[model samples]
Target: MTKKVRSVRPDTSFKETALALIQNRLSGVPVVDRQGRLVGIVSESDLLPREALDDDLLASAQAFFEGTFDWDSLFKNRKAVALTAGELMTTPVQTATPHTLLRQVAKRLSESGLRVLPVVDHGKVVGMVTRHDVLKVYCASDADTLCNVKDALEHRGYVPPRHCIDASVHEGIVTLGGTTIDPEGLRRALALVRAMDGVVAIRNLVRVDSSAG
Candidate 1:
């Protein structure tokens, strides 16, 4: 997720939004309220000359309007806005949470046909997750995944002793094996691993350390 997100105000004019998108080379941007809460999203698609937009918007707007688009996947938020971004932007947009797994993000994008998904926390935009961002996980090597898994377990206080736990990755499939005296810790550990961005699957072979009582 991109924490430093670019956004627009609801009152922004069409031309202003278009120029910002063009100069920044942004395909789309989120619409934020006074408190920076996500109200809607504006993508290149919003600028396109649909039956809704006038002819003058074709060239400059085309580079944007005809070019890129962003908004709710179902267009349920679609309304008629001639010149302002407030009415033009799409609303009720699909979103993801900070803890959302990359796999889940990928699935949402694929199912919804959205170019970007906003990361929202408590009605505020925290970050932006693009298709490119989700795809980057596939580029990660197994070594990287193992390192992350190890790092995660180390930071967790609920997990078993780090030295007693073993993790191995093969082609992004992670296997966890060891003995843990804390059943709850093992449960948490498995959940942490399952959410890793690069993890394709998780196989747990850990046993309970019954002797530790």
Candidate 2:
């Protein structure tokens, strides 16, 4: 999650929001209160049409048949008009919590067709998560994943000679081999590997020894 996020206040003008988005190269910005709680979100799509224009009425069958449409004129008019972020932003914003799992966050973004999600904690805005952020998990290098897994195992005292666990990573998948006298230790090691960043899957080829202590 990106802890430092660019945002707007409810009363921020639409022109300012658009300028900020263009400057920051972002598609949208979260609307927060003075106390920093997410209230809504403003995107380029929301600001495309004139806020004062009644889109539902203008797009009606009768209006369309009348041939009174002028796309360029309408788009230009919207930009010429000044509106506040609260007037143009979308409400009931979707968000993620700090404790939310990465997979779950990815699912939410996918289902909502949104490129960014605000990370909230205790009803306050904390950070931002983008589609790029989640994609990085799958793009992790095999060598880095292997090193991370090894470090995690070593931290838990589950490395070779101590627990007889051998690890190798290929294409983001980790394969564990060798012999372990303790079944629970093997389970813990597998769990660690599964939780490691960039690990696509796990192949547990470990041979468990029940008699050896």
- In model 2, where do residues sit more than 4 Å from their true spots? 1-4, 48-58, 61-83, 96-104, 120-127
Taken over the whole model, the C-alpha lDDT of each candidate is: 0.78, 0.81
lDDT of 2 by residue, 102-186 (tens): 8888889899888888889998878878888888998878888998999999899887768888899999989998898988988
* Candidate that scores best on TM-score: 2
TM-score of each: 0.61, 0.73
C-alpha RMSD (angstroms) for model 1? 8.2
Off by over 4 Å in 1: 1-11, 32-38, 49-81, 92-113, 117-127, 157-163, 209-213
Worst 10 residues of 2 by lDDT: 73-82
